[model samples]
Target chain A: MPSTEYRPPRPFSRIYVEDAARDHPETARVLRRFSRSRTVPISHYKDIFNRPRQEWRAQKESPALILAARHGEFLYDASAYTPTFGHKRFHYNALALNCVYDCAYCYLQGMFPSAHIVLFVNIEDYFAATEAALAEGPLYLALSYDTDLPALEHIIPYTRRWIEFTRTRPGLTVEIRTKSASFNRFADITPTDNAVLAWTLSPASVAARYEAKTPPPAQRLRAAAKALEAGWRVRLCIDPVLRVPGWENAYTALVDEIAEALDAGKLEDVSLGVFRINRDYLKHMKRRAAPTDVLYHPYEKRSALATYTAEEHKSMTSLLRSCFARHIPADRIHIV
Target chain B: MIILHTALAAEARPLIRRLGLKPGPGAPAPRLMVGDGTALVVSGTGRVRAAAAVAAAWTRLDATGHAPSAILNTGLCGAADSGRHPRGSVFVINACTDTTCGRRYYPDILLRHSLPEAGLHTFDKVIHSPEEARSGVRTAPELVDMEAAGVFEAGTLFLPASHVHALKIVGDALTDARFVTAADVESLIDDAIESITAFAAALRAFAASSEKSGRVLDESEERALGEAMDALRLTATQRARLSAAARHYRLLHDAPPSPVLAAFAARPPKSKNERAQALDRLLHALNGV
Candidate 1:
């Protein structure tokens, strides 16, 4: 039998201590998981989490009761910022971090120090914080941008809480996004008009390669179908279209399957984008990724975004927009 | 192609038959490239053996000067939780964990989220309950196979940054002499073959690009990696600590620890039987589980 050896914990960007007043008491609770290991000489760590920047003051920083944060109570700002496309005018909140699935191409590779998940149970506090920050009415919030809130329903049931919280405020609309097939968790919940569910999907081929930790694409679609039937508004996100030899056919097949699963008339929206990362994250990506040319291409610098060249971005986005529009209204489409 | 990790040769004979080939007489030195790109090497279920097995596989590829895009550690992992777990379910691991101690790993391909996450972890011990399995998950390992981490490390020896795609099937969770049954073993093996076969095919089919990068040990790349480490604020002390850790890895790669090798060399195999046994052991260890 092989002996178990210690592998150094991956690098961390920053750490936040859960102050007594914070929203999520659970954030600090999970960080101490290793405290028991301190008794062993080899297991002791200098600091449970890296606290490089408690206050850079240059970077936008906030610390509350982080219920649970991915990658050691650290969240990357500007690592990802999506502009709501179509009828959804909202921003995604990665307040809780890391999904239950460990997909190969997941952006978490560059975002976290460890794979252990951290959820900020004080999510309601984040909602309160969001409400306080938003002077506008009816602002849509993406709940599971960095993690799957619904999948954890079997465990943490955070998404259920979010739904209840959203139901209280008519001005607050939520979009619970997921790639999980754990649809049974929400099979019985009555849908709220203010709550929109966006399912991030990839082609079967993509699932076979990079989506190893994810439920099969069809399973996710089946979940989406159930949600739509339960009277939930659904959006299809095929962003980060990974480049494979036959991406055209693969995406076509994905859309076809999704279209089959959901009555196209009830399909709320669809958004798609080619895979691209900001240049800063490109550094982190290089350190931990597998062999692939899809990510290493020279990106174009546009509006401080490192992505495909103008023509490539425009054409690709336009192509995807049309591909998605073929199944849903163009007004319902959003590019994130 | 299917990957097998059982130590039982008599049972393995049936697998060989399924592949329409006879089991090689008495476990010959684990062959490389026996079935083209799909090679079978014994990765005895543990960390050290798995690492060694991985290294041996790399040595074969290293001699040819070609590296495989994927390295998989296929095996049976036991835990006493059949009531909760369907026997044949397959999982690809995210970390190789030592559940006895809570050591965990973040594989080269880091999952964006935690569930929907499948990874094979090489563990020295077996977990016997849903609670034990949950603890394994809490340790941050998705799948608890025996040897993928070592195999991944061995691949790292050659590529220094190769990623291992590992998977495991549930075998006997806790099979005692009386508790163990051929029916149990066959069920696990069948599930293993199906899952591994699907896993290999899935990798081939799912060609995807996420913005993942591999840093070469080369100077420029090293600087980039170092800068990333710095951005992550690996404290200067931490940097030095990592340096010391890197030193050990370097020593292992370029040179074998002398005293141990000398002892093995001194007692070289004298007969073909001894050689075969020695080679099998070495080959098995090469898998590094």
Candidate 2:
């Protein structure tokens, strides 16, 4: 269906999900294959006994897990970051894609054909590949390309797995990018010094509206607080800060929540980015969400992208930096 | 019979599966597909590597246990300019002239085939758009790819011109930059599989239909074969004589090489004006005046 055409969420009784442990066993388990029209024969459920299972059991199918199908062997991928705004990022890879949760602004929806989650079950292959790549030089790996880990933590348990995996590989660090505040799960697990638990945050109201199927902002903060309390390194992301109504209050309230739960000392860095896309994506969003003021903004063409006007991006980032700098140091706050 | 060959077996398996085929019957590495006459060869992904594959298949077919009557090169291709052609489509190059070596050849064409002639292009790197795609269209090479040269080169060693052809699906736009989606590209594979099936069926039907017409070759068949040899950049008369030698003379013996053609091949005689001057030079030499 055209993204402009509202697709009622699909629910499937059974579908095939590919995820395995023993590769990046430190990573969360990926479960896919349930959607609106597709169904799995009950025999398939019994056949599950034939395969191993992991913790990340994302429930929503079709627009849920098992997003699309692909035919190829080794994925020809390498670290690709913007040439200009080269964030202090060494490298990246596709560990997982099109998260289990459905956030409105997610790029996966436009990228993937099927909304079905595709958990590449061959964890060993990915691990061997990642480990071999890391052996070449010191680098950082970005995890949770599509969804937050903690939410699927109960099922996939990917972030915790990465924490464990990274500890074994020297000169390797990981940034588990996510919005889920399910940090309590790691309270008992040993925290890795090489791991940076980056918590993706949006204002409370934005989370409530756009971040459906995701934990509330407070819950994510609680998770961040637990990661801090557990002596784990941390980073904060105030990315894609939507210019919703009461934008200032929403962000201010979010800062207050973080201050209460997360201590400044525990954070390695903080990133504040205004909401943006490649503009073409916004066209679909505009059609999908008609008459939504947030969809239609005075974005400019920068680097062939429809981004916040220079002034808008500058103001949003500056305001967010100021908000956090009041509680932290200027060095700790970063903007991209 | 859809014969897909690659230097790599592992890479070809996924493509075969996507075509709704399963490795059938054979125990260790079964090339046999009981479901359909779809033969996939995993030629390693490269020029020299795939060239070896095409050669090996031709070798195997000649005086071997299993031999195929026809061949089709199938796989993904990076479009030089994919933005102009978003959906994956078929490319049929009637003639291919490589500018690097100044070698020209007509690749075998499946006539009246249901495919589009999108022109030719070259890729130094993975091309994603027309702006980035090599300007091969002016010469009108319907599609430009790495493996086709190997396929055409090897197919000529054995198969009749009617028995060989090259086809590809636009996997990525070949251009200066890259703009592609795996999800989008794979869907083109699906479309490719559909057309490939239809083309395979039509060719097979034609071949079967031709058998009923007896062993007497048709005039178009003779001309098509001649065109292929011409694309090989052989002089027209030389191509005709050589094709006749293969068809009627059956002369496998080494024939004396042509000195005049050899001299022209060595220097190409430059442009038409330069060649005209060369002709005068040649006439003076011939007349000894």
Candidate 3:
């Protein structure tokens, strides 16, 4: 049976603030938000985030918050694994190091050593770095690669700030992807042409089985519909489509449901990709995480990457594309 | 198994008696007591000795194939401020600092416990006065001990940070380390015996329930797996792939892949090509092709 158990979001019981970032305005604001949580001071966020022998499962159950100031290297070139949506200059930055939702296929589980959420309080620095890069040419930046900024909008107005910032910078375009359904947080903001609110919508069965602590697909569709009605450039991501049993029927039903709920012509684009990960990251994840069908899949390992065999990938992508092509134009469907 | 480490024998005596632990036959260096799935080690004074004792005891206990799941460091400590944490008050340490090296270790407290929590400072030398205590530690030292940092450093090497804990009983006022008599130390531990045993039990339960399930094969199936491997005559890479495939099969079906391998076990491959084909067929079957 699908899990109908209602899980109230677990609050951070403890907050670790870096000594240098203790007096930052963002840190102070977050402290005010979680006023009741115990605050511990640390020399650096790495002291806790990179600690040895950290139990990722236990920490994920009740994750703590670490606020620190990022010093250098705020922007990184986008990897081939992530689709760029036809952008020439694609880069991503991590305002937060870890995510709030615990998807079974999330690569962050293997990328970071600790499960604690580390929020960098220096947003102005990231903005300045982006502005510096935009001087040469047009830039497309991914602001929510390592975390769901929209889910954490209540904690800090990062998504709103980035959206407002992107409105004036004609050479800059930003993509903020999330599994959150809380669109009311941006009710007051003006819709922007350069900012894209990408929502990852999975099949109900896949979401129930693999995506933990995320809003249901129905709610996510409602949020996407609201965004589309508000004249925002919204992207529907059916990416990382899992090849579970009866996946074709599940994905077809999902596509039909989405078509019934929202107008397909208004969407900016639809992104599609099969599940894949770094081979080393999969090894680390398998060592630390409990057994799950997704993690334990015998993926075809090839040159630092682990993914389904070509035949399986072909079969999954073809099934999804044929169904999605019914509503969305073939030109608007991007296969990463 | 839950293993307890104490700096002094007096500190360990109360737990040994309360938990009904007896002398465990192993190495005689650290002096181990074991019974009822619990073990206690009397690590001598100082951080170095405590670290060495914990490492030694863990190695010895793990050699028997029944490895410890959790480790608890229980001992008496000096309260930096007597008014705040009075004599005989027990506390669960949330973080510990080593004064000599300025290194810190935070124990992930995931289990539920009723004891009050405090930060600890493990100093090499005892603080003789309030001034010494204030200057010796980097910050306000609520609880002062000599083995907490050492215990955490060594214990985490064997288990996860969540499974390593420290419970301290305040016995002095940060004036002198040797001020408390052996009887006084014993009484301090005796006063907190209930809390210690309860916390240990919670740790043991957490460790027991947190063990990963649905492994590729169990103890009873190891011999059969070995025989199958021999029958298939797989190379190193093929063997690893088979093991991974078996794990995936077990996760998907909640049953071992021995039944799938049983088909190939009776027929040995005559040539390298035949062996490769056999491996491919077994792998495809295990992978749910």
Q: Which segments of model 2 are wrong by more than 4 Å?
A: A1-12, A17-64, A67-89, A287-292, B1-289
**By summed lDDT, which 10 consecutive residues of candidate 2 chain B come out lowest?**
B248-257
| iRMS per model in Å | 18.5, 30.4, 8.3
True contacts kept of 3: 0.34
Name the Cα RMSD for model 2.
25.9
The numbered model that scores best in TM-score is 3
Q: If the candidates were sorted by their lDDT against the true structure, best first, what order would they fall in? A: 3, 2, 1
The 10-residue segment of model 2 chain A with minimum total lDDT is: A49-58
**Model 2, DockQ value?**
0.01
Ranking by DockQ: 3, 1, 2
Task: Find the 10 residues in a row with the least total lDDT in model 3 chain A.
Answer: A1-10
Model 1 chain A: lowest-lDDT 10 consecutive positions: A53-62
**What local lDDT does model 3 show for residue A168?**
96
TM per candidate comes to: 0.47, 0.45, 0.93
DockQ of 1: 0.04
Model 2 per-residue lDDT tens digits across residues A153-267: 6645556766788899887877777887666677888888888888888887888777777888788788887888888888888878876657888888888888888687568
**Cα lDDT tens digits for candidate 1, A80-100:** 446554323456576555556
Q: Model 3, B49: alpha-carbon shift in Å?
A: 1.4
Which parts of model 1 have CA positions greater than 4 angstroms off?
A1-81, A86-89, A134-136, A301-303, B1-289
